[model samples]
Target: MQNRSLRADDWAAEALRKYSDMVYRLAYAQVRNRTDADDIFQEVFIRLVKSSPEFESDEHMKAWLIRVTVNCSKTMWLSSWKKRMVFWEDKDLNRIPAEEAPAGNEALEEALDSLPVKMRRVIHLFYYEEMSVDEIAEALSEKPSTIRSQLTRARKLLRKKLIGEEAKRRVQG
Candidate 1:
């Protein structure tokens, strides 16, 4: 029993090491705040330890983490404490970490940040995490068609925001 416990502990640590960045990034993408994202990140791994779920494979584990992260973000948003707290429209609080963002991507990042949270999640999963529409739907508990529609709408919004509609039309023409 002791040996099993130790093995589980080790496995949990390894999983944290392997998936921490992905978890944090996903959380940050959803919450749009570093502090809340950090809280979500910790909550996710704590749940993992508490549940001690056995995954069939790495992909299964990744999927589980994504689902949990999304759920946690939702819970955070719905929490009474979150509801009561007021946030100032502070640009610094909402900007992505400089190191994580690539050079000349600030405009794009700003455009992404302007998106609604739901659109941001789909965009992050599809573009950053490279998850398929079906996978994002499964993780987000939405239908594939919904995920596809969100992705399409998100892209259009981003395009319109990043480059004016006139520029898009001129490019196409």
Candidate 2:
């Protein structure tokens, strides 16, 4: 029994090490605030520790983490505490860590930040995480068609926003 418990602990530690960044990015993508994202990250790990649900495979474990992170972010988004708190200034647009972003990629980051949460999630999972549409749909609890549609819409919106921003800069310069 003790050995089994130790094995579980070891497995959890490995899981955290492997998936922490993915979970944090997913949380950040949803909430768009560093503080909220941090909270969601902690909550997701806490749930994982508490539940100790058996996963049939690594993919299943990943899907579970993504779903939990998303649900936690959604809960935080709709929380009364979150609703009541008001900060007048927008957070700095660079919530993503500097090291994670390539130099001269601010335009792309801004375009991504401009997207709606669902669009951002789909984009991140598909492009950044390199997950397939079906995998993303499974993780997000949406249909594959819905994931595809969101990806299409997100791309169009990004293109329009980026082009408009560039045009404005050109006119000003």
Candidate 3:
């Protein structure tokens, strides 16, 4: 029993180390608050440790984490306490690493931030997670067509925002 427990601990630690950033980023993208994102991150790992679920592959595990994170975000939004509370907008919340951004463009990050939560999630999963439309649909519990439509709309909106920003800069310059 002691040996079993040690193995479990080691597995949990390895899982945390491997997936912490992905979980935190997804939670942060959904909640848009560091504290809440931290809470959701803990909650996700807690569920993983408690469940000790078997996975077919690393991809399966990643998909499971994405589903849990999305569900937790939804639950957070639905909670009465969350509904009543005022959100303090964190300016730096959307500042991802340079490599994550398109050419490390601040304008693209700002445009992504301006998107609705649903569209933003689709964009993040599709681009950052490199999930296919079917994978995103499965993880998000949406139809593939819906995911595709959201991707299309998000791309158009992003393009418009980026183009508009560029035109404004050119005019001012």
C-alpha RMSD values across all candidates: 4.2, 2.7, 3.6
What are the models' TM-scores?
0.82, 0.86, 0.80
Candidate 1 ranges with C-alpha deviation above 4 Å:
3-9, 80-86, 89-91, 97-101, 165-173
Which clashing pairs does model 2 show?
Answer: none
Comparison by lDDT, 2 against 3, better one: 2
Task: Please report, in order, the local distance difference test score of every candidate based on alpha carbons.
Answer: 0.86, 0.86, 0.82
Candidate 1 local lDDT, 36-112, one digit each (tens): 88889999999998998999999889999999999999888887674436666654654667887788777676787
Per-residue lDDT of model 3, residues 88-120, tens digit only: 674454345567657837777678778888888
Ranked by lDDT, top first = 1, 2, 3
Clashes of 2: 0
Model 1, clash count? 0
lDDT of 2 by residue, 40-94 (tens): 9999998998999999999899999999998998888788674436654645543
- Model 2 global lDDT (CA atoms, 0 to 1): 0.86
- Of the two candidates 2 and 3, the one with more favorable TM-score, higher being better, is 2
Worst ten in a row by lDDT for model 1: 1-10
Residue pairs with backbone overlap in model 1:
none
Candidate 3: stretches off by over 4 Å: 3-9, 80-104
With a 3 Å backbone cut-off (N, CA, C), the pairs that clash in candidate 3 are none
